[model samples]
Target chain A: MLSIRNLTADVDGKAILNGLDLEVKPGEVHAIMGPNGSGKSTLAHVLAGRDGYSVSGGEVEFEGQSLLDLEPEERAARGIFLAFQYPVELPGVNNAHFLKEALNAQRRARGESELDSVAFLKLIKEKIAQVSMQPELIKRPVNAGFSGGEKKRNEILQMAVFEPKLAILDETDSGLDIDALRTVSDGVNAIRSPERAIVLVTHYQRLLDYIEPDVVHVLAGGRIVRTGDKALAKELESKGYGWLTGRDEAA
Target chain B: MTTGEQRATDLEKVLRRGQQQLAAGSAADNWLSAVRERGASDVMTMARPDRKQEAWRYTPTSFLDKAEYAPVVEGPFGAIQPADVEELMLGDQQGTCLVFVNGYYAPALSRLAPGQHMPQVAVLSGQLGDVPAQLKAHLDGIAEHHHVFAALNSALMSDGALLYVPRSASVQAPIEILHVSVGLDEPGICHPRHLIVLEEGAQAQVIERYCALGEAVYFTNALVEIILRPGSRLSHERLQEESALAQHLSDLHVRLDEGSRYKHVSATLGGAWSRTDLRLNFAGEGAQADLDGLMLARDKQLNDVHLDIQHTAPGCISRESFKGILDGRGKVVFDGRILVAQDAQQTDASLSNHNLMLSRSAEVDTKPQLEIYADDVKCSHGTTVGELDHNMLFYLRSRGIPSARARQMLCQGFAEEILDRIENPALHGRATRLLTERLMTYSE
Candidate 1:
């Protein structure tokens, strides 16, 4: 479903992702594990078409089409979603209003009729329950004065509503408590399907326990060093990334 | 005479053209006649404010120098339709209504509430049915003192709305005053005066609106004075929507006594050049004041807002916030000052002025000042001028919304805060619709 061939990118002229390569097929879930500053978030940004990232070398393709040539909104309309680790708070913009606009925009792009407020509200009510978020929060401004856990749950809610073809979660579990972690995991697990692919980028293997991945890849020095089955996650959790690399401490 | 002296004399000669005509001509023995005479003399000597003055530093005075103005002699309430006035009226609002056309009272269009003992509502030239004898004592008490515009408005003062709520009375319904200006053969001027007095423990809500009926060059100079006695509460909303060729100027002065509260919201949405000068004075202890303003300027329009707040007693609180959104080479100026007196200990005050520029040529000059003499007071003043947030733009785009639509949504949200501050639902909804329509048609 996706392919990255010797992809190299830089932020502010400093190389972050150097010669990174990866492949994922439909109906597969891949977990990428890396230590701090291992270019985990950089890979996610490159795929999502965020600005300020320069692609120095190589190419990325999705379904036989070059992904780097598309704009951020264009990629989003094509069913590519990126759940930001730190969702931006927009003051005075209602969450429900923003989500309805987003959903209708994607529908219009797909040559479908737009949903009115009554119909959109009915559909969003169901998704709101799936993510276990208070309906009142949806009426308030988008993530303004929201707690960290609520922000993560709101991201998951968007993922469920969007139903993207490829979902990329970047450090989404960093600021969640145990209860919030389980609720977020449940939300993610419920959205898993055979026709969709998801990429999980994290430093801990605890999330792997709730939503198990079909494959695990070790990322070090901005490249995928090793690829193995689910057992590889447990090995890395026990020995840490320092055990795989020869360094005394993990970056 | 020297050149400078000759020029000054010529300016004074021009300023006295309309000083002798009084719309509601009263007895010479009446106190109002003396005020008019004083105001006219003041205008003759005191020069019009220029850019060199600190208060008028950022606002241009070239527009005021274009043509000579004469008093608008109530031109026969010509071709004005009630439907037009109805369209501008607050939807389904139940209140006492007073309609004026070119500063003349329109009896057929005005409606008086059906209450025998409520507040007195009448035109300045009509009988004051239930008003107290002290009404004259409070007139011109706290205007933009010594300003040429205020003096000019006082010099040609005509019929206006007079509302006075007695002591301990609660006026449940709001008082609505609509000043409609229609075009004339040549450029004309109208001066509308208003006086609102809420006695001790009295409460009321008032809405004063200024609108234009045609696209012709005219001048509207209005004055509003409000006094809140001990333990009184008042909410005042002023909306100005004139034609693109019209120039509107207004001065608002509010005085709060012990344990009183006053809330004010002013919006300047139309006109070629618009200015609303506001002054608020906290006279007694434990008083609270709130001043909120919004301005939308487009198409070479210029909107200037100046606010001055004074805290004279201890344990007083005041908050002032003004916002502007300018597009299409529009210009806006905001100068806000808050002063805490020496004995006003434990006073709390905050002032904020925010501006958003939608075009590179759009101009916004904002200055927020705080002058504090009391050591135990808490005061803060801040000013911000910038474009839309990049993160907010990217977030909306990442959700598949177009860039233009995303910006529109953000701009609407930015302006929605002021509208939401209005407590009246009907007024809030109407302003929201108006603002939304403007935002839809506006583009950078």
Candidate 2:
């Protein structure tokens, strides 16, 4: 469903992603694990087409189309979703209104009929329960004065509402307690289907415990150095990334 | 003579012609005659404001010189239908409406709640027996003597709405005053003086609306005087949506007694040139005042707002917030001044001015001044001028909203702080719609 080939990118003229390559097929769940400053978040941002990132070389393909050339909104319309680590706090903007606007925008771009307020409210209410968010929070401004857990759940609520084909979860478990972590993971697992591809970029292996991935990749120094199955996470958790890097050097 | 003096000579002709025209419409009433003549002489004494003056530095009054001014003739456009006045009404405020066309009251277009339940409402010139003493006492009290436009309004003012609430009267419904200007063969002018008084423990809400019926080259000089007694409360809203060729100038003077509350919202959406001067004085202790304004100027339109609040007594609180959205070479000028006297201890005052510039050529000038003689007082002022936040734009765009829709939402959000303060839901909705329509006309 998604492919990245030698993705050479820089932030502020400093190379962050150097000749990184990855590929994901339909209905597969992949986890990209790395230590701090290992370019995990940069890959998420680059895929989302965020500004201020200069791509020195390489290209990204999504469903056989060049994704790097599209704008952020175009990428979103084309079923590319990035659950941000830090959801922006938009003052004076109602959460429900924003979500509805986003949903309608995607619908219009896909040549589908837009949902009215009544229909949207019904749909969002069910999703609201799916993420276990308080209904009143939907009426308040987006993420303004929201708790850390609430903001993460709000992001998942948006993801569940949009129902993207390719969902990129970037550090979705950060700042979440154990109970919230379980709820969010269950919500993500419930939405998984044969037609969707999930890419989880995380620093720790704790999130993988709830929603087990079919493939595990360790990203070190801006490139994928190790690939294995679910057992690899447990092995890495016990032995640590230093063991992997030493073996890589020896090899 | 100095340039200031020379400019005054040329302005005097236009003001004098208006005074003569006003005199031709009125009867031989001693008190009314005396007030008009004194007003005319006051125009000569104050002359006209020039660029040299600090208050008029940013606003150029040269457009007044280019047009000849004549007083609107009486009964030339016949009577106005209530339907015509309804177009300018805010939402569904059907309580009481007083309509004035070309500075003359139209009884057919005006409505009042049946019977004694209605507060005392009358025209200034129609009834003289009970109005003379009150008019004489408060007419010249609020507006300063040096303002050239106020002086001109006082000189040539013919008729206006007068509302008085008795002691302990709590008016639930809002009273609306609509001033409509019709097309004229010559450039015309109207000076309407409004007087509102709330007695002790009284409460009331008033909306003053100014709009033009057709394409007219006219000038509307409006003066509003409000006196709130001890423990009284008043909410005053002024909405101006005049013709593109119209020029509007208004002076608002408010005096608050002990434990009184006064709130004002000024929304300026139209007019070629508009200026409103608001002066508030806290005469007794424990008074509260809030001044909020929102202005939209486009296509060479200019909106100027000047506000002055004086904390003369102890334990008074005052707040001033004004915002402007300028596009298409439009301009806005906001000058706010707060004064805390020595005897006025424990005073709290804050002033803020924010402007959003949609076009590179659009201009905004904001100046805030605070003078505190009391050692124990809290006063602060801030101003900001910038475009929409790029980060916010990207955030919205990332959610699949188009760039233009994102910018519009942010701009509307920036303005909602002031517009949301409108208590009437219908009025609030209408005003929001009007602001959006006005914004869509400007090329991004």
Give the whole-model CA lDDT for all candidates, comma-separated.
0.83, 0.84
Q: Can you write out model 2's per-residue Cα lDDT over B1-444, one digit (the tens) per residue?
A: 112332222557767676666556657334566667777788788857888998898888877676666667777755567787676766666668888888788877777766635467777767423464554566556666558788777777778888888899988888888889987876777889888988899999998888888778788889888999899999887778888888898888899999999988878988899998888999999999988999888879999998888999999999999999988889999999998999999999999999989889989989999999999988899999988777777778777888788877777777877887777776677778878888877667
Q: What proportion of the true contacts does each candidate reproduce?
A: 0.58, 0.45
DockQ of each: 0.65, 0.60
Q: Give every prediction's interface RMSD.
A: 0.9, 1.2
CA lDDT, candidate 1, residue B107: 74
lDDT of 1 at A115: 95
Candidate 2 regions exceeding 4 Å error are A239-251, B1-10, B28-30, B84-86, B127-137
Worst 10 residues of 2 chain B by lDDT: B1-10
Write down the lDDT that model 2 would get.
Answer: 0.84
